[model samples]
Target: MAIPKYHELRISALRLLSDGRSMKLRDFLEPLANEFKLTDEEINEMYPSGNGHIFYDRISWALSYLNMAGLLDKPARGIYKISKKGVTMFNSETPEYINEFVDKEVAKRDKIKKNKNPEIKIIDLNDRQTPQEGLYTSFNNIRNSIYEEILTTILTKTPAAFEKLVVMLLQKMGYGGEIKNSGVVTKQSNDGGIDGIIKEDILGFGRINIQAKRYRLDIAVGREEIQRFVGALAVAQSNKGVFITTSYFSKGAIEYVENLFGNTTVVLIDGKNLASYIYDYGLGMQVEQTIEIKKMDTDFWDSMANQ
Candidate 1:
């Protein structure tokens, strides 16, 4: 069976502590996995960022929500026990109960904020995703929309502008040291297949050749195109090359570069990755706003209590 969503884990987690036994947060993993009959693969599935186990993360969020809603009590660090309210909730509440509680809590907090400052706005909550998850999802969505806009804007520019942009992006990424004229876009004519070059040092002892293709989104840069770029690298006597395109590469093109046996190395940057790099490196983009998410500092409170 598919792994249960974090919200779905709420009632099950409450049920686990319904017997009045205190369990460390880690202790809940095994029994919950067993109760859900989750496969080993499902239990160990990871987030896209590969930071932590997905199932374990969901479980932690479930416990946190229960604790916040006054259904669970934390008597010691990393340990949790069901409260009298939790036992009552386990017997009476349905799976959807946590969502209603969270919405009400958010409304209450917003109400308090509005009383202090009349301009305060109520926050919208997604029943299926925790706040952190929703924030990341919204961030990714905005970034993806910007990527489409970036590609469309790039396509509107001349081919020479695209070549210069690629070179500038590499320079911004610190490919070349701080040296004047370290990166240059070659003249349109008699430049061979290479469109740009980056001198890796002040003396121009090492260099990286660049080939930028401003192709339509539907176009796929094929093996022959990559071969020509490699040949251009050979002519320039440079062993490193970057083949960037506003379109994706064909399977054969990718495999050809992968299986090459020599000092020459080529890196392919496709449309999606190209846009992401531009956004990440702050190339031709500006930060319009910044939002900071803050959490309680438990250690500060612990130190104060001891003092």
Candidate 2:
């Protein structure tokens, strides 16, 4: 099932904590996941940032909002319990009361700020996000879901296929002059750590060395692997290389490339970045739909004001 929205999570959390017993964050995750009827695959689903599970992240946000609104309290690290106010509202069968209480609290806080500093503008805390901010957040969530799907599909392909895909993506980004002569995958026997190569022009004045690593998502590409690719580049006398991996690179590997000082140029594309590029270049993806968000034309309105 799709993850629940923040309000839904908030209500769920209050129901779970209504017993007045504290619960660890980890303990709360599974019950919530089960309550939502999330399958194992859905439970393991990650945020596009690769930072945490999507369900867990949303629950955490819900907890944060509730705590700020005084509906929940953290008695200790990683532990959360319902506040007296939280229990009262949960027992009253009026979920909307929590919202009203939060709004009243915000107004009280704003009034205090205004009284303390007469010249200071008191912003309405209850109206935190503008319409534009809400729209952008929704757009980003949709975009991230697409990126995650792209990565999952790519992981199922063979290494050779992944290499070809990297080449195709680069071509779509305008790497080579034409599609027919843009790039080619090398024979395995003589590849020398290079999976493919892309010519920058018809005359081949510049070329980009490509090394595509179809790695396990949990593992990382280290500096040693990068060093091997660098050796291969040195053998070919090429100063430009692109190392694309379906996993992340270690800090050491990233630092090594940054310190090159123009000796050689290596562009690293991890799984997250590769998905971003694929989406940006419209490679292997179609236009699902278009959303247009329009704003007022201030210039036109100002011209009308002059009349």
In lDDT terms, which candidate is top?
Answer: 1
Q: Model 2 has how many clashing residue pairs?
A: 0
- Please give the lDDT score for candidate 2: 0.81
Query: Which one is best on TM-score?
Result: 1
Show the colliding residue pairs in model 2: none
| Candidate 1 least-lDDT 10 residues | 117-126
Per-prediction TM-score: 0.59, 0.58
Sliding window of 10 residues with minimal summed lDDT for model 2: 116-125
lDDT of 1 by residue, 1-307 (tens): 8989887887888888989999987888999999999999999999776767999989987887677677898776578999988888677876577568754664575476458446333334545777787777667656765786689788988999999999999999999878889999999998899999999988998999999999998799999999999999988988999999998999999999999888999999999889999999999899966777898999887778463
Provide backbone clash counts, one per model: 0, 0
Error of 2 at 101 (Å): 27
